[model samples]
Target chain A: MSVSIDARGPRWSAAITAVVLATALVTSNLWVIAFQAVVFAIGAIRGPQFTPYALIFKKLIKPRLKSEPILEDVRPPQFSQAVGLVFALVAVIASITGAGGVFTIAVGFALAAAFLNAAFNFCLGCQMYLLILRVRTAK
Target chain B: MPDVHYAHIDAESHLELVRKLDIRSTPTTLFLNSAGVEVGRAMGTPKRAQVQAAIAAIH
Candidate 1:
């Protein structure tokens, strides 16, 4: 089933993600990364609407909005959260294993994706979803 | 120097091609032999020396 939501919600969530991830990177804090992982896990499994950042956007930011946002399908953002979860999981594992290089790389990728969405409204994971769809249909 | 051919695919425009190639990230460089079989691949930004080494190995 498709669920429609304000497109700006995910973007707002992405802005928070970018900030959280950047802070994690700067501080080299595994706990912060772990926290972000939980957020991603909730978004991926339950839906983006259930994410903490999304809730913040809905409760604190939505009411102050000046205009209505374009509605979009929730599936893509959910998929994007799943992608973030994978990266977060990898970062967590690397941190636990003491693989500093792997942890940094995983977090770096996740940060880049989040920054792209927050700054440019470009959802890399959503693009990947569309590409996968095209590939499946082409076969 | 061996003869080498170069081709570029804009991943943003060619979604199907990008999917077909299983490219997960950008700035990915794939080296293929004359028979069109993939010989080597470099993901992310690679140094020029590294790229030359990869090409030489594939050659």
Candidate 2:
């Protein structure tokens, strides 16, 4: 069966990620960043509804919105979460390995994608997901 | 621009479109004419002015 999405879930997830990541970046707290990354990975692997941000939105934010909600396929955004997980993992590894540049770059990349989603409703990871599928199916 | 329209294709069900369009990058935009002919394309994150110009030239 196809997944029913409220669309707002992913946007809120992105917003939460952006805020948490920004905090991590500013505070230089590897532990907090690691927690954030793990949360992102879990969300991607399972579903946005399982994410903390989604839960918060469902409880506090969704009730306030008056516009009609819409649903879309889950695969694309799910794939985006996977992409996010990868970046977050990369940052985690970089921090553990003492590679500051790599950590910054990884977190920065993830932040940019999340920011795009929260601000413009665009998914760069979804675009990459399409390319990967194309390559896998090409032969 | 009246006839201009766009779509957001994902990797799950629309893999065929992704392949057919040769989409190797994110934030790609394709400009097609009324006949569904591809006349222009962009492969990276483009600015608003660039998109505006592309849509303005759409036929």
Candidate 3:
């Protein structure tokens, strides 16, 4: 069995950047942003890889999203998609409560982070993993 | 040099595809001209400049 680590932010960042660029070019209305938020929330509600990488995550050496039982060898996804699901729930509630501006701004930041990964191969998710692991292992 | 579009090839079919070619390495690059004639080949990641030169020559 081969063990593979699933930690990279470039691909996800690339996807987010593409989403933002397309959205920014085609939309200026608050309702458009809210619609996009709802779409993303649906994805989160489904699961992590449910929205992005739904096709290839299963094929990669190390998946960034988990859709199957973790192999004895393959590393788990870097982030808990369940956590993202929770955020999606919060985002949906926030939008319904007329706080969509905050969630949209956060989505904007995620888009920026994706572009950063594309240009620099930086993985913000990996950094987040490091921080979480440190906190977990700290005595 | 052969220009290959690396598509998502599955492991089950990887060996079959490899056998059809003259490739002899885990990572092999084949260079070909517009006529589909091979001019150069290499094992593993070749220098970008070298690949460019081969394609330029073919062109």
Best by lDDT: 1
Candidate 1, residue A20: CA error in Å? 0.8
lDDT of 3 by residue, A1-139 (tens): 2333322332552455447534742453445445545444444454334444533444552354543432211111224333333444454465557675655554455555555555664435434443454444444
Note the clash tally of each candidate.
Answer: 0, 0, 6
Candidate 3: deviation at residue A37, Å? 7.7
Query: What would the DockQ be for model 2?
Result: 0.27
* lDDT, candidate 1, at A43: 92
Candidate 1 lDDT tens digits, A1-139: 3676787898899999999988888877889999999999999999998899999999999999997676666767889999999999999998888889988889999999999998987788876765566566666
Which interface RMSD values do the candidates have, in the order shown?
9.2, 5.3, 16.1
List ranges where model 3 is wrong by over 4 Å.
A1-13, A16-77, A80-88, B1-59
Better of 1 and 3 by lDDT: 1
Instruction: In model 3, state the lDDT of residue B19.
Output: 46
Candidate 2 residue lDDT tens string, A28-73 = 6789789887787877888767888888989999999997786656
Best by DockQ: 2
Across B1-59, the per-residue lDDT of candidate 3 in tens digits comes to 24543333322235444545634432356776667677887653466788778767767
Worst 10 residues of 3 chain A by lDDT: A69-78
What lDDT is reached at residue A61 by model 3?
26
**Cα distance off (Å), candidate 2, residue A35:** 1.2
Instruction: Pick out the ten consecutive residues of candidate 3 chain B with the lowest summed lDDT.
Output: B4-13
Which lDDT tens digits does candidate 1 get at residues B1-55? 5478888665646767777788765546898877889988876445678779977
Ranking by lDDT: 1, 2, 3
